[model samples]
Target: MAQWLDAKVTKRIDWNDHLFSLRFQCADFPDYTPGQFTKVGIEQDNGVVSRPYSLVSHPQDKELEIMAVPVEDGVLSPKLHELQENDDLKVMAPATGFLVLNEVPDSDNIWLIGTGTGIGPFLSILADSEIWLRYKNVILVYAARHQNDLAYGDFIQQCQSQYASQFSYVPIVSRDKADGMLHGRIPALLQSGQIIQQAAQPLDAEQSQVMLCGNPQMIEDAMDVLKSMGLKKHLRRSPGQISQERYW
Candidate 1:
């Protein structure tokens, strides 16, 4: 059984034609970890159509935030994209996911990599100050199809400024010309060792912990590249150097 509470849309930031970020204020917000997700729904003529979205806001934030990209024919996203301030939405608690920092073991460096809306959880993780204290270095590698598709650039820049030497932000654009951003897919960057080169750090299995999120194929391809470097999937039963979450 799950509890569904009403959440009011407080703010909406449109990044591009297809991507946006939504902020919701819930009366009885569930206690959630940094990298957890909640199910959101809207009343439909036939029934309630719901989808799970990762929380982008840190636990200390007053409101919950979730980022999304509207699929052309998506059941939830199209409706979600049309949401206006003060609109009521159904939010199912308690948020759940295995992508939290506790799943990662001690390492010299932590890599947070994502594509598209998969970057949601990573944003939450970065917002929490605990990660800065826990790891020696934190790197965020965000990949999008176009330069404008990159969301939260300002926020990420703020984090880099605040963290100074300990944080790094790398943006990858696959289909557009970006003066300073990487210009290839994440898997290719990993395979070519360009990501590590850009970061000026080593990504060995023993010293690095990696988290991957987004398209399943990207995850699979990146895992293969990581495996070749001696990193294996991290599991509760068999902990390793890598963890992942797949976006539908």
Candidate 2:
């Protein structure tokens, strides 16, 4: 059985018409790793409906934060979007996920590639200072449909300022025009060697570790491109260079 605790919405930030982030205060919040997810439940006519949301805040943050793109007909998203400050929701304890840095072996560079709301976990990971200590370089490649869809710009900028020598941010806007942003999909950027050219670093199986999250199609396609470069999926028994998580 799942353990659930009552939480109160402390704050909300609406990034756009379709995307928003919510911060909830949970008295029983667990000590979760940076890339883990927690289940959020709301009572509905159907009894209770819950969904897993990756934690956007660092493990030490007093409030739990989650970024979400509201689906037109999603059972949980619509309701979640309607939530206001002080609204009550249920948060499941013992957050879990496999995207943590512990799963990745030490490497010279760490590449975080994400699309849409998939950028959530990366936010948590970057906020934690440990990643800066472990890897010599940390690069974030975020893909969104439009310029405005790029979330956490301020936070990422703060990270860049704090870890100036070691951190880099690359924003990829696929559909709309954007100044200083890569206007293409992630896989295309990888295939065309544009990302590597911009980073000025060679991403090989030996010296680079990669974590990919976002649209299932994007993940699959990006994996294909990475494989061509000799990067294989990381597994427990056969650890390799690439690790992935699918965000629905």
Against the true structure, what is each candidate's TM-score?
Answer: 0.98, 0.98
- Lowest lDDT block of 10, candidate 2: 194-203
lDDT of 2 at 204: 90
For model 2, what is the error of residue 203's alpha carbon versus the real structure, in angstroms, after optimal superposition?
A: 1.0
Q: Model 2: per-residue lDDT, tens digit, 89-182?
A: 9899989999999999889999999999999999999988779999999999999999999998899899879888888888999998788788
TM-score of 2: 0.98
Inter-residue clash pairs, candidate 2 = none
Candidate 1 local lDDT, 89-170, one digit each (tens) = 8899889999999888989899999999999999999998779999999999999999888999889989989998999788
* Candidate 2: Cα lDDT at 188: 89
